[model samples]
Structure formats: structure tokens, C-alpha cells
Target: MEKQIDNHYRYLQQHFSYLIRQQALLPGEKLPSERDIGERFNLTRMTVRQGLQTLEAEGLIYRQNRRGWFVSPPAVVYNPARRQSFIEYVSSQGFEPSTDLIGVTVNPADARMAELMKVDKGARLLFLQRRRSIDGRPVLIEHIYINTALLPGIEKEDMSQSLTHLLRNKYGQAYHSMNLIFKSTALLEDAARELGAAAGLPGLHIERTNYDAAGRVLELDYEYWRHDAVTIQIDVNDA
Candidate 1:
């Protein structure tokens, strides 16, 4: 029975995958209802859903709450090695970029944060939560911890604009370098909800520590990105 179910789901997966590849299902085009698909394929709704999920994991389709699934748009190319801000890189790729300030607060650093920032525990940090979108589709959630000691009064500035711009123009500081880590992980429930993605969906997790000319950590960034929304590309360095 298990083997039969697997075959059924694989068939369903291939059916949709082929159509999407042929462009019969264009970007932003909606797929048939799950019930409809199940009936048409003579499969259980669970099997139909399993197949659709396989396509989703492959970055071919996405679902919106109450609206059903739609063919995913082109993935935004992201270069972590590039020194470009999200707005800069995204716009350079010809996609519209926008940011929404989810919330901002000041919090005392914990032991782990202190170690990461090279600051004493209880040092105040400016925390910002932001949602970034491409072409009006929310794709990334940013949880940024700024060492306010390095860039005082930053909390007073507009939080929605690019922090890199603020750092350069007002504070006279820039991202001189960064320590970065990337992982493929399941999206946190809250982050998934914010991105309009399913809970526990696979996502790209990026942890970046931006530094100043003095090699001091300026900001620590935790980025959660929708799996289908972006692709990572790293240039080979001959040196």
C-alpha cells in the first residue's frame, strides 16, 4: 500500500512538473484546486497534496492562504559575496524591492549575543524586524541586531530605509567586511506566516555579522528567506 501511494504521488508530481516546464502553467498562474486535482487523477487528496508539496520543495509552485497554489515567479539571484545591500542587488537584477518595518525595540544583549558582538552582557542593542519584498511579494524576514554603542542615535533614523545607506551617509560607517553562514532549514512558524509560506517549509537561513573598518561587529543579521524566492550564487575567486 505504501509503495502504491508513493507511485501515485510521484505520478501527480510529474504531471504538474511537466506542465510547468512546458509553460502551460505560467508564472503566477493558479493550479487547480486540490480536490479537483485529486478527483481528476483518481488519487486521494492526501496523495495529491503530497505531490504538490514535492513540486513546492523544488521551487516550482507556492500557495497563498485561501487562494490556492500558484506557479512561482523567477527566483531572485543573490550573491552573498557581493557587498551590495538587499535593495541594491535586488533592484540591480530588475526586480522591484520594498521594505516594511515590522517592529523596532532596544534589548539588552544576552551572553551569546555578547560573545558574538564582543560586547559585555547587558549592553544595549537596537533590534529591528523587517519584511522585504520583491515585486510586492514578501520573501525575506530580517531580524537585525545593531550594536547601538557603535552607531548611536540610529534608532531615531527611519528604520525602513537601507541600513547600509544610513550607516554610510549619517554614521560614516560601512560594511567593510562580514562573517557569513548559510543553512537550509525549516522556516520558523512566525517567519513562515510573515512570508505567507507554509509552516515548517524549507527556507534559506543566513546569519551575517557586518563589521566596520576597525573589525568591530557593527550589526548581526538573521535572515529567513522563502525557498522559492531566491537562489544563491557565489563567484569563484581565483586568488
Candidate 2:
């Protein structure tokens, strides 16, 4: 029985994988329901799920909590070396991008945030949270901190638009330099829920510090992304 289950799961994986590679299943196309798949393959639902999980791990597919599995879209190429906004980069790559402002607040910075922004511990900081999507698929959740003292009245601007564009147009400010740190970890519950992803699912975390021409920290951005939704590409120019 165990051997039969092994072969069954492998068969399921290979069958779907072949169809995906042939483009018979286009990106974002939904696969058959798990019960249907199990019925077709004469396997248990649990076995079918295991096979689907295998495909998901290979980045060939993804599953929403109750939405079933879908063929994975092409991963958006992300270049930290380039100073481009989410809307700009995603559009340049022939993908639609959108941002939904989740929440915004003005609050005193904690000791850690104050040290990072180089402001007084009790200084007001603008906190902005947004969910960014590619091709109508929610792929990123942003937790951004802005040094309000540096850019007064910024909180009044429309928060859903591109921050990079707003900074340049409204304040005549652009990032002169930036610091980025990355890690692979389980998605936070809040982020996962916002993206319709399963809690504890593996995802990417990015911490970014943007600086102005005078070397003052302009913004701090924390981005959480679906692991399969993007590929980080950075071109370094040492010369």
C-alpha cells in the first residue's frame, strides 16, 4: 500500500508538471479541484495534496487558502541596483501593478526606530502600510516608516501612489543611497492574511533604508513578499 501511494503521488506530480511546462496550463490558470484530481488518479485526497505541495515547492504553482492551486506567474525581476518604484518596474516588465493603502499613522518612534532614523526617541514618525499586487495578485505587503520631521505634510498626500514618485514630485527628493537586507523566513500572520496566503508559509523579507543627497535617512521600508512571486536581481558596479 505504501509503495502504491508513492507511485501514485509521483505520477500526479509528473502529470501536472508536464502539462505546466507545455503551457497547456497557462500562468494563473487554476488546476482541477483536489477531490477531482484524487478521483481521476484513484489516490487519496491527502496524497493528491502532497503531490500539489511538491509542485508548489518548485515554484511552478501556488495555492490560496480556499482558492485552490494556480499555475505560478513569471516571477517579477527585482533589481535593488536600480532606483525604480514598484509601479514602474512591474509595468516595464509587462505586468500590471497596484497598491492598496492599508493604514497610516503618526506615532512617536520607539528607541529602535529612533536610532535607525537618527531622530529623537519621541519624535513623530509616519507609519504607512500598503499591499502591492502584480497582475491583480497580491504579492507584497509594505510597512514603511518615514522621517516626518524631514518631510512635513507628507502624510497629507495620497498614500496609495508610488512613494518614489511622490518624493520626487512633491518634495524634490530622491534616494541618493540605500541599504538593503534580505532573509527567507516564514511569513508573518498579518502579512500572509493580507496576501491570502497560508500562515507560516515561507516568504521573503526585505528591510530597506533610503537616504537623501545630504545622507539623511529619508525612509525605511519593510517589505514582505510571496516567495514565488519575485526574483531578486542586482547588478553591482564596483568601478
Candidate 3:
């Protein structure tokens, strides 16, 4: 049984790699039916399906009901030390950058948000919610909290473009670094609405704390990435 499972996995790895290299399994392209793969491989349909399932679990593919599996697109790898806007980062990779402003307002910071943003409770903060996309498909939903005192005119700024750019260019605030924390959680209704994900589906949640050059808190951003839409890569250097 162990060897059988191993063979199935090994065969799947070869088939998946071939598809990727050949563009047969193009990024965001739905895979063929399990029956079709089985016929092509001369293997049982169950085995083909199991292989696909393994690929999906490994973050190489995603499944949608009635739509089958599709190859996942590469994620935006952000360097914490680099001072570039999200749009700039995405555009550098030859992808179109766009933002859909879900909502934006100034509100009193809650306890949780205060801790994340390093602000006092009830402090005024700019709360901006948005769905970021490359081309047209929604990839990430972000909730950003900006210190109102730092960027006094943040509310009047354009909501359609990169907030970081506006802050650097208009507010004269330069970003020094950002820390990202990751966790797994089920998608809620709000997340589903922004990410086009089904409610209760699993998702990748990331909390980002951005700081200014002077070490003042710039913004606290929470982003929810749709499952299968991204594969995160972390490069660690031994000190």
C-alpha cells in the first residue's frame, strides 16, 4: 500500500511538471477531467483523482465545483527591506496592477487594531479596505490602518491607487521596513465577498506592520489571500 501510494505521487509529480513546462497546465488553466487523465495514463480513475488531490494540497493547483482543478499563479514575493509599493512590485513582474476600493473611512482604533498599529485605543485611524487584483482576477483583500496624525490628508487621497505611493510622495513619509505574520483561517462572508471565495473555505491570512524611517508606525494591514491563488516563498539567510 505504501509503495502504491508512493508510485501514484511520483507519477503525479512527473505529470504535473510536464504540464507546467509544456504550458498544457497553464497558470489559472483548469485541468482535464480525472477520467481523461486515467485514460491517458492507462491508470484507474481513482488513482488519477488522488494524484490531482495531492497536487492541490501542495498548493500547485486549486479545485472549484463543476470547474475542476486549475494551476495556481505565482504570488508576489515582497522583500521586507525593499521600499516599494505593492503596485510597483506587481508591475515590476510585468503584471497589471489594480485596486478596488471596497470601503474607506476614519474610525477610532479598537483594542486589537491599536495593538497592531501601536496606537492608543480610540485614536483616530484611517481604515481602508480594498481588493487587489492583477489584470482582473481578485487575489487579495487588504484592510489597512494608517495613523491619522502621520498622514493627515489620507482620507482625501485617491483610493484607486497605491496607498504607500501616496504616503511617500505626498506625506513625505518613507517606509523603512515591514513585518508579516501568517496564519490559516476559514474565509468569512466579508472575505468571500472581496476574494470571490466561498464562505467557510480555507484561506491564508497575513498581518503586516509597516514602519517609517524614524521607526514610527506607518500602517497595520491585514490581507486575506484566496486559497490556491498564491504560494509564499521565504528565503532565510543564516546569520
lDDT of 1: 0.92
Kindly list the per-residue Cα lDDT of model 2 for residues 57-95, writing each as its tens digit. 778898977889999999999998888988988999999
lDDT (10s digit) by residue, model 3, range 1-239: 87976786678767896877687767888777887877877768777876876676556776665677778777666554556677887788777778999898899989988887778999999888999887666878998888988778778888777777787789887677778898888778988766655676677898888898878898988898876665556668798
lDDT of every model, 2 decimals: 0.92, 0.93, 0.78
lDDT of 1 by residue, 1-239 (tens): 99988888888899889999999999989999999999998998878888888898899999888899999999988887788889999999999999999999999999999999999999999999999999888999999999999998988999999998999999889799888899999999999999988888899999999999999999999999999998889989789
Quote the positional error of residue 91 for candidate 3 in Å.
1.3
TM-scores for all candidates? 0.95, 0.95, 0.74
Candidate 3 has what TM-score?
0.74
Residue 194 accuracy (lDDT) in model 2: 98
Give one clash count per candidate, in the order shown.
0, 0, 0
Q: What TM-score quantifies how close candidate 1 is to the native fold? A: 0.95
Q: Candidate 2: worst 10 consecutive residues by lDDT? A: 56-65
Clashing pairs in 2: none
| Deviation in Å, model 2, residue 215 alpha carbon | 1.3
